[model samples]
Target: MKVMVIVRATKSSEAGEMPSEQLLTEMGNFNEELSKAGIFLAAEGLHPSSNGARIRFSGKDRTVTDGPFTETKELIAGFWLWKVSSMQEAIDWVTRCPNPMTEDSDIEIRQVFEFDDFGEALTPELREQEERVQTEVAERNNNAQGIPASKDEDEIRSLAKAWSGSLESKDVDAMLTGYSEDILLYDVKPPYRLKGLEAYRANWEACLPYFPAKMKSEHRDFTVTVDGDVAFAHGLHHVVPIDEESPVGQTWLRITIGYQRTEGEWRVMHEHVSVPFDPMTEKVSYITDEVIAETI
Candidate 1:
């Protein structure tokens, strides 16, 4: 489960009083512990309400209100995003947290709703729009902060190159660096579906004998899309024999990779590799089809 841990504002927090060095150190250590436990996703503290504003809606009309809100206890001073097993688990973790404020404070834990929580109500179109908005929001935030929007795209492109390089060298351990432990892959070969890191490594080992001793990899027409911590890329790939007449010629296989940014690193969680298929021929069609490989 995912949860939002909200730290309620206190009189001192609303006054813009910064935490003492000792308190800050304690909180930092607590956060480090949370991160090491794989529970921390993000944490941030806000400036006092005096630096913020509120917008009120009345039908089509709007009203702007200045802050330093009177309800100090109701306003939030900081928050943390965490992925945990259950509400009780979140509570247990929270109990170990250092005091967020020098004075008395309150922290509220609320479960975040997953997309599946909507059941059948969230249609495909709505999910698409949601994903687009998420991407735009991340881009805009980075732009507003003077950060390059293409940073993640550059990383993903570099990762693609690194992946092909690993494949060319036939190094399963190197290739597994960017993959998740519970990775899932749908391949072009028989027993096409592979799950877990071990199965993926075995798949590579099984096919290595068929590959030429010296090989080169080519990846083309690659495109990447990122939405916050989730990203995906698709491209056409070919493994070429360096001089030996290989059994498998330079066949172009369509490849798609699903990436998740966890603990500040992007890892491939799902992958799909296949050749084009023709319904009329009822066999694997040999072509570099430009259609999208998969959807979010």
Candidate 2:
């Protein structure tokens, strides 16, 4: 069962008096115990009611009241969400907690409702809807234990890192193996988009002549995301000519690539690359700080 541990506001809490260091330390220790026991879900301390508001509902009408609500005992200062076997277990855990405030405070434990508790009142359709909503929320929080991916994120990341090897070697065949026959690409150069594998190869072949015979390819601030059969990555690519005097090098050429898992293999489906330019002069700009890694 899930229960909320409500920390009832006291006179001191309502007055916005902070808890002493000793009390804070004790509460921290108690929370650590809960975490180690695998009973902790979430916890938070709220600001004083003076920074809060209340809404009253009657039929279709509503009204709002600003707080420091006078009913200090009825107000909550903070709360924790916990999952335990039963309400009694929640009570036992609460009893073991240290004093949370400078003055006496009442902690209330209220059982959170489970779908089963609604009994037949919750129809199969409503239950399905609720389950779907919960699943979505859990997935967003990375708590959806039942939802598993294809376990190819690492493989995709490996592909990204290996591309530099092909670049440094000027191995067009090796680089082509990473892309699909239907690959689409948008390069920093003209011909806005390249469609199909032939165009992809042609673009590479055209650019290879200008590339340094001996160069170092580096990718920085790279991020890869995989979802089922689809994946994407973006990063700054830096290519340096081995000859210090050579000018055929780039510092922050932005690169974005898309991947698709087909059958049992992953392939590049799309790609986009560009460099930042100054709007006024329409000239390329260099980033001095952490700018190259995070954004376009």
Q: Which is the leading candidate under TM-score?
A: 1
Candidate 2, run of 10 with poorest lDDT:
287-296
Error of 2 at 175 (Å): 56
Name the regions of candidate 1 deviating beyond 4 angstroms: 135-296
Worst 10 residues of 1 by lDDT: 287-296
* CA lDDT for candidate 2: 0.80
* Candidate 2, 230-289: lDDT as tens digits: 899886677767655566654567789999989889999999998778999989876533
**Against the true structure, what is each candidate's TM-score?**
0.48, 0.48
List per-prediction Cα lDDT, in the order shown.
0.82, 0.80
Clashes of 2: 0
**Could you give candidate 1's per-residue lDDT for residues 6-79 as a string of tens digits?**
99999999999999999999999788757644467799999999999999999999999998689888899999
Q: Pull out the clashing pairs in model 2.
A: none
